[model samples]
Target: MGRWEPDARGRLRAAAIELFSERGFDQTTVADIAERAGVTERTFFRHFADKREVLFEGSQVLQATVIEAIASAEPGTPPIETVAAAMQAGAGLLQGNRDYSRLRATAIAANPSLHERELLKLGRLAAAAAEALRDRGVAEPAASLAAQTGVTLFSVGFEKWLTDGAVDDFALHIRESLAELKALTGDA
Candidate 1:
């Protein structure tokens, strides 16, 4: 399956990024993405409802993975610490694919449509996290605030690392960002 189909979703995403970057997101069609992936348009739809989804895919996976990571964190860890640990896990998930991230980030930055979708993806991820926090026994505002703060730290850490050519360790950057956030809000 990893050979023939070879993660159809991933292939579609890579193809969509390349096409969007080369031809502009608005100009690129699902067929273009499918062709670039050497797959059928039907295959593209199977993996994603449309081209916008190609950019948003990781946000969904990230949310789910982070939630699982948080759920499995040591019981003694504080709620915020658990969330931070999950963010570190997410950073790990993205660390091996800097080139792909650069491509997607550039593509999103260049295209207004992609940018909107990216923002929506971030919001959805935060909301999902807040729901997970509630399940983990966190209260109202704290749950939402903690989740959004985690997302913000992740975003700042990612950009800082990316701008510095990923020189800093991504996990460490997130931890520092979280500390800075705590200092700013006096939440720590």
Candidate 2:
């Protein structure tokens, strides 16, 4: 692959994940990723601030997708249900990338810093969901509770989706997790 090839950003992300998987996150460097991607260090910097950003670059898109779903949900929908649906909708963005997601997850899990960054990204998503709920006129505790719970559901569901070789639909995992939550709360 040439540095002038299309999808330099994608190539960089792929290279970063591959290097991270093969060499360990802490052992990998920007130069290594750039070399693997056949791009200059400047090109990598243009696409990502650091190696960690390669893994988290889609967080904003994920957050926006969830927020849009929440905001566009039918009026009068229950807060929890709205958030769950929003999360399920957000899951669509990850649908075709299970293998990539699995590798990314493994990389994050192996590094404490990456794990913390992942948690922070989830926290931001939750906060964004909460704000979207509030925009929908949901009350204080209800908005926060629903948003936090939705994020938890997404986290657990995503793990199940990653680990379950037979499951291919992320939305299904989210729905199952939501159902399990409802059952646990005696609301099912």
Candidate 3:
């Protein structure tokens, strides 16, 4: 087919991740990602603001998924359980993207800036979660604590899922992680 084909966004994301993994995030350019994606620089820019954004484009969606999950929960749901439910709901985002997720994690881990960006994204998710919890009538430190705890659980679960090639279900990893967290706290 032609060079400027369909799935420009997906192509750009995949291309950016591959290039970032091979050449390092700082060394890789938007033009390089565009070329690797078989598209033009304009097409790349249309999909992502910069190479850094390629790694974080899903942050908003992930946050939104969690927030929506929290909002949809029963009014009487406890704070921690609300957070856990939201986390499990958001696991759908990573469902079939294990290889890509692993590559993205590796790419982010290798670069301080990328790692910072990831932390910032997680912070945003936590803040959004806290806000959602507050909307559910949860007060101050408890909301923040539950939200951060959920983020921690999700991060740990994602790492375990990436490292354990045998695990195919991302949600299962998250549920297991949540169970582990409860066990650790003697709440299980």
Candidate 4:
């Protein structure tokens, strides 16, 4: 409302989520999101590539967080442990964003195209993670397996955190998911 407003991207994102929840992702347009945020369509476009981009803008940052964590992990740490640490590191990005995350997840779940896009983003993240693991000198199958498995566990943890509403700690859920994975694979 002032000349010095902060977080225009956040405002646009919040408005987009609200509009999508009320009108459905397919029904919501970039113009609608901009109006709701009290910004112009140009402002919306400046922040997001399109309406769908609002929901996925954080994916790139999240992937970078995971990859950096993997790359910086101790030299001899097991691949899975490195992944769990990476998941934990990535979790910080979404911390205290539970409500926005829940709304985004709901919108993604209700749309087939959005769901496919989400899967593609996750796949890319997994690929990046695998490449990071290889940089750590992990062998082929082990690196690939650990990366995919980490993505799966991270996905499950995020779902639980977003949907439960009562869960206050996203990282804890991720760590718990990793523990379960380790237990299942007898790596615990």
Tell me the TM-score of each prediction against the true structure. 0.84, 0.95, 0.94, 0.94
Per-residue lDDT of candidate 2, residues 1-188 (tens digit)? 44466899889989999999999999999999999998899888988898888999899999999999999999999999999999999999999999999999999999999899899999999999999999999999999999999999899999999999897999999999998988899944
| Candidate achieving higher lDDT, 2 or 4 | 2
Off by over 4 Å in 4: 1-5
Model 4, residue 131: displacement in angstroms? Answer: 0.6
Query: How much lDDT does each candidate structure score?
Result: 0.82, 0.93, 0.89, 0.89
- Across 1-188, the per-residue lDDT of candidate 1 in tens digits comes to 34567788778888888887788888999988888888888877777877887777677678888889877877667778878888998898788787788888898899776788788878887888788888888899988988888888888988877777637577888998888887898855
The list of candidate 1 runs beyond 4 A from truth reads 1-9, 166-168, 185-188
Winner by lDDT between candidate 4 and candidate 1: 4
Better of 1 and 2 by TM-score: 2
RMSD of each: 2.7, 1.8, 2.2, 2.0
Ranking 2 against 3 by TM-score, winner? 2
Order of quality (TM-score)? 2, 3, 4, 1
Considering every candidate listed, which one attains the maximal lDDT? Answer: 2
Q: Candidate order by lDDT, highest to lowest?
A: 2, 3, 4, 1
How many residue pairs clash (N, CA or C atoms closer than 3 angstroms) in each of the candidate models, in the order given?
0, 0, 0, 0
Predicted candidate 3 versus true structure: per-residue lDDT over 27-96, tens digit per residue: 9999999899889898787777878888988899999999999999998988998998899889889888
